[model samples]
Target: MNRREFLKKTAVSAAATSLLAWPNEVWAGGTVNLTILHTNDMHSRIDPFPNDGRTNGGLGGMARRATLINQIRQQEKNVLLLDSGDIFQGTPYFNFFGGELEYKLMTQMRYDATTFGNHDFDNGLAGLQRQLPNAGFSFLSANYDFSNTILKNQFQPYQVFEKEGIKIGVFGLGIELAGLVDKKNYGATVYLDPGQRAADMVKQLREKENCNLVICLSHLGYKYENAKIDDRKLAQQVPGIDLILGGHTHTFMEAPEKINRTNGHETLINQVGWAGINLGRMDFTFSKKSKQKINVAAAVLPIGKTVISS
Candidate 1:
């Protein structure tokens, strides 16, 4: 969908009321609302795009995004700021600073967690490890085994977050790096099968951890015409993931698409465009009576001067 249509369908003023059709009784019976804000492939576009007559001109700036996030935080009680990956490469900021600025800025934003994109390996494992101290949040990667590399024990396979007595399980998955990345850059970072890893993660998160909501921070592309294991395929193959926030292909989805799983469950997949043009938001309400059951609403907030004024 185009930007105009997307904004029309998911207007910022109407997002909270229109996304989900749950009744008032759900909120009256001790329902907890969790707001998830996500971004992906923000390849060092710290400043707003130049107003050079391009389609993306005058859109996307970290400061503007921060303003929007702060606005939301003031209004919402439980909020999670996350990224899907590819936090490096694209602009001269990465070339000069080597991801230090990116990490520092995301730290300032209080990002809860993030996954790895193939470009994250551009500077090799050591470069990534060197800048880890600047980040205060966690890095989650379920499929990439970092045992043999310098990143061993640096990332968790999955993390469980408890907010207002609700357990939210979050995990990360990266695309295969061997073919997409330089061998020297991603040396010894063994890539595992994402489908098997996702199944294992879901089982552990649901059965053992007893998580109320399961989310996957996936760097897998949204969908591929070929037989690649993209987010759509992963959602179809795995039954328990409630949501997949995706990246890598830089797809600008008009809205989250629902994929039916084999076990009669539905997984929602969402991806904003690259370069921090949009911030993806998903609100989930869980009742005390049924913590495992949830009602979700999604919106894509465009970051710009107009948005700040609105």
Candidate 2:
């Protein structure tokens, strides 16, 4: 069976149902730290897995995820929650509701933004578009040209946000979904060359928009052995993209990979494992003392088989 099929057969568990200490200094302190929380290849597994003898038996569920997100947002002065994609198709939740539950839960969790994955088109363009309005966060896909379709103006090429004196630019890049998805499902959504589009968008975000941190929310997976384009290639070829949050490969990276781009700019790539069993967190610390990016502490936190609330 294909990877998606394997996950579909084994990953489904439950529906959406229902963390931590803040340093006192955070509410009234200097050295503002930005916490970036992310997920990918969620695949609509809305509940923590039951005791199934698997390594991650009891982890992941939208309700547990929301509890964690709310806890962090309440403490951090600046927090950005994002997802890379594959937000549809896995459990009967998606099969029955047609992605409504996933989008609604994501909306409740306040996802800042997300891209597209091939599986997102399982219900076809009309089905996906029908549920679009329910999403609180904007959908961005720089390389997917939706012109001549209903999604043209509804989606953005990139989004810029200024948080705590920091400028962040986020955009999306989709994998080539032709061979991966049914032609009838994706319809006339023209897929552009990701490398070319990445270069162009990075230039615009860094030079024109003056965004200090440029991030690419990618559903392009990570490195592949062959010539197939992936996130690693995009990072090496595109300059000025500070980070690439990736999906589509279900790559559970130990930590974010630091790579030097064509212009010698540093880019960090990270992806949590599939099924929401892990939550990827990257802490960006900008030193006002030196006026530079001082450090990045990255971790993949496990939700691990049980629901915990703070």
Candidate 3:
């Protein structure tokens, strides 16, 4: 079969084999379930849109998102909340406080990890560096090299989380910053090839770190017509990446896309709309019997008035 045909067949088979068929040994070894909640391109939207007749009016406030997240945490034993960057810029909040309030509020919301988007450098490296202390979570990025910059020691390439005996490895990937960002803003931050870097990170995570699952937080857009590397291409280029949470283009996907990769492996890619308009969720069930066996369920939650008061 050609590459395209093989990819299609592999995608279908992988999804069905993992989701439908379960080995008998799986039941004996017990199962671990993890719920991953994520947001992308939040753009410093701290408050809901004005109640005016705009499309997203009265939706997407930090308080409302916090309330929904709290409710989910209360129900799920093992949960991870992550962001896909562009955390800065958009509203008056960022304009006045220079991303300080954005990080503080995300800290309050208990974000586990976040990546940096192009707009994140809008206030310059010094601007973002100043607000790093306000964040309770880690900033992860494998592709952006900050060795000679103020952010050199600030962000991590990858993070490992062990929840209920399941080891999850998550790393970050950013877009090419040269043309997208101002030279003054992203000074000395080298942008590596995401597909190449992701391959290396996943290899380490799976082989050396012994992580049961691997996730990629990517600022690469969903897809492009000109063959620029995006999440879909990244998935195919790298192996062992279980899921990719993406941002940058603000493509709203109703469900996660199952992308077939080399060697029969598949990657699930999901992205929510921008401006904190929606929350993306993916649930994974892993069985001890077959380490590669997984069942995934995905959903998108529209941001609106929550049970918690504003």
Candidate 4:
């Protein structure tokens, strides 16, 4: 469909409300709302800041984020929590416990999936390997070959989640680890082209896995002036990706950026910045009759001191 047609369809489908209860029947076939909650590059800030007059002081602790996520889970019938990358490094917590604490806490938060970041190798291959089992969630990295390394059997390429009858496929695409990451830390792990990996994995998820929605958890940042393959570039080059939750640039976006794919399909790219400064929420509604996704509404929730009310 063209952009104008899609917009008209969005509006038309949105008006398919039930008179009896409204809001519940927003699609021709009853609609199922899937709430996607995401974050990126949370670098081990276990505790909130010390209220040093900085706006973000005492804002991004795991406690606050957990409470917020729990509240959303309670309210939303179908919710998927995901993180892009850079789950390790930054604070003294990483310096002290390696990546154990971060993974453990993410397990507590019930993160469905995540991707790898360069900083995850801060403690070297041994460090990430040591804390792998502590993570309750699976890491979905389509690229980053761990065939002959300690991380060989630790990660998966993608994950499929059945939420409220919507088959959601979540995949990960890591940036090139060679030039940016130290060889000593990365060991013999091979890095493939993210563009190719995205095309391949997204195709599999869309065609083979039969996922209704495909999301790419990318650590390639946003746009770059230096001709880097960021999320914007990925959206244009790769096909069949419905959404891209990005990281590595630490960009705090208020809403999703809509990009047109090669097939002229809309692709949404969103990022919540680093340090858990915001929570990116995208609500997708799927049709019960046709079982097709009909509409999407997106907004970013900023994480201020009061988000937790602690």
Candidate 5:
């Protein structure tokens, strides 16, 4: 289907149910289910937007997000919370705390992993390093080479998580920072070719590691008219990537775009808007015997008063 049609179909599907329902047939035959909850470009929104009658007024807040995540964790057995990037900057909270509070709160909410956005370098490498201790999760970025800076050996190219006999391999990709971010802020950090890095990660994660699912947390936006290698391009160039949770464009996609890869496999790319206004969720049911994905469901849930009070 075309992008517009795909989006329309999925948006309608999501509107019908807050959480997509998994068909019973897909759950039969010893299938394992996993729920992935994700956010991107949160930009240090500690509290909900002021009730100023604007479009996004009273929409997002870290507290509301935490409560929603906790509720999902209680319902799902295998849950992974991930962020695509830009965990820092935007609001006064980031300006005052320099991302320390953001890291701490994400730690409390038990974020599994995150990638780096260009704005994440606003405080420079040293500042980011100082706040690293507050985060309980790993920073995964396969494309950015930090060996020459203080961030050397600080981030992982990818991470593997196993739950209920299912192995999940997750890696990260970042946007090129030269033009987007100041050179002084990202000094000595070399940006690698994201397509090549992703190919390498897929080989290791799928062939070497034998992961049942492969996910890429990408900060490469969704798509670009120019040749900037956005998430859509990455999906087309790389094979074996099952899902891509993306950011950097703050594009509010109601549903994920399913791209058919060259190798006959498919990839799902989803990115919620910025400022923690929405949470992107994807549910997958896999066959335990064949180690293949059987079914999938998704939703872009808005963070509003329906959730517990912040």
Candidate 6:
């Protein structure tokens, strides 16, 4: 799982015939291909940008994103759609609907899971509580202790999904909400250390749950010049996370960054830009005989523009 080995495993070129026949021959054989589609920091841009002269003019919209996701699902058999949080605020849609439409639309998109970002507390805890039922997916928050608040039992720390006999474990990690959020808004939620919580969650998911792949839905920013617990720092600190889908910094990573883990394994960290402009896709091929994932491919599909895969 070193950098070289990681590259070799996922080094299959996009032009390879094996990749072309992935959708058909994957499940029939002992290999299983799991496609993970993700988004982050949507910020309630339900409609596309106005026809003005801005740079992002008409570049993003829910309809286009939905169409792209649907097309991908049609080709890929086992797919998991996920979000990395900040689904609220920014646009006037949230100011008017209080995140109801956002949740409903995501539910329609069949998002498997999402984490909590600081802006998720914009309408305060009560507003989030009201919109919780509208979402079709679960909210995973491992570092946020909502036990003493009204959000008790409302969110899970981790979830396991079985796709084509491969057990995939996913957990959530949020940024520290103290300085970023108002006390009146967040209420009695306790924030735990993401690094420690992640270590514990990874141990449970890898050992007790026996998951073939472990993913972390992180609302932490990508990285900081200063000392901050960003996604890169988290990957270096935690051992078991195979992938980290991050938000909060609105980083438009052209591709996933492979970080060499302390245990000699590698962790993939990816984040699409904000405003529903991009969809992140990662494909991992698992070998049944070895009980280990062998291949990894990623594609960053533009929402309303041409598609690009790497």
Mind giving the per-residue lDDT tens digits that candidate 4 earns over 1-310?
Answer: 3222322433321121112223545554577878888999998877776789986765677877888788677767888999999999888888888888889999999999999888988789998888988989989989899999988877889999997677999999888888898889999998899999998988898889999999999998899988889999889888788899999999977678889755767888989878876677777777766567777776566554333221
**lDDT of candidate 6 over 1-310, digit per residue (tens):** 2223322433322211122233434444587778899999999999988869988887889988898787667767899999999999988899999999999999999999999999999999999999998999999999999999999999889999998789999999999999999999999999999999999999999999999999999999999988879999999988879999999999988788888865678888999889998887787888765557767877666666744232
Off by over 4 Å in 5: 1-28, 305-310
Better of 2 and 5 by lDDT: 5
- The model with the greater TM-score, 4 or 6, is 6
Off by over 4 Å in 1: 1-28, 305-310
Q: List the residue pairs that clash in candidate 2.
A: 19-310, 58-305, 59-305
The count of backbone overlaps in candidate 1 is: 0
Query: Residue-wise lDDT of candidate 1 within 1-310, one digit each (tens)?
Result: 3323433544553243234455667656787778899999999899999989998899998988988888778767889998999999999999999999999999999999999999999899998998899988999999999999988888999999988889999999999997789999989999999999999999999999999889999999999999999999999989999999999999998778889765788888999989999998887878865664556767778887335322
Clashes of each: 0, 3, 0, 0, 0, 0
Local distance difference test, each candidate: 0.87, 0.81, 0.84, 0.81, 0.87, 0.86
Give candidate 6's error at residue 241 in angstroms: 0.7
User: On TM-score, who's better, 2 or 4?
Assistant: 4
Give the higher-lDDT candidate: 5 or 6. 5
List of clashing residue pairs for candidate 5? none
Full-model lDDT, candidate 4 = 0.81
Q: Write the per-residue lDDT of candidate 3 for residues 36-120, one digit (tens) a residue.
A: 9999999989998898999889888888888888877775678999999999999999999999999988999899999999999
Please list the residue runs of candidate 2 whose C-alpha ends up more than 4 Å from where it truly belongs after superposition. 1-30, 289-291, 305-310
What does candidate 2's lDDT look like per residue over 90-110, in tens digits? 899998999998999999999
Residue 37's lDDT within candidate 1 is 94
Over the full model, what C-alpha lDDT does candidate 1 score relative to the true structure? 0.87
Better of 2 and 6 by TM-score: 6
Native-vs-model 3 lDDT? 0.84
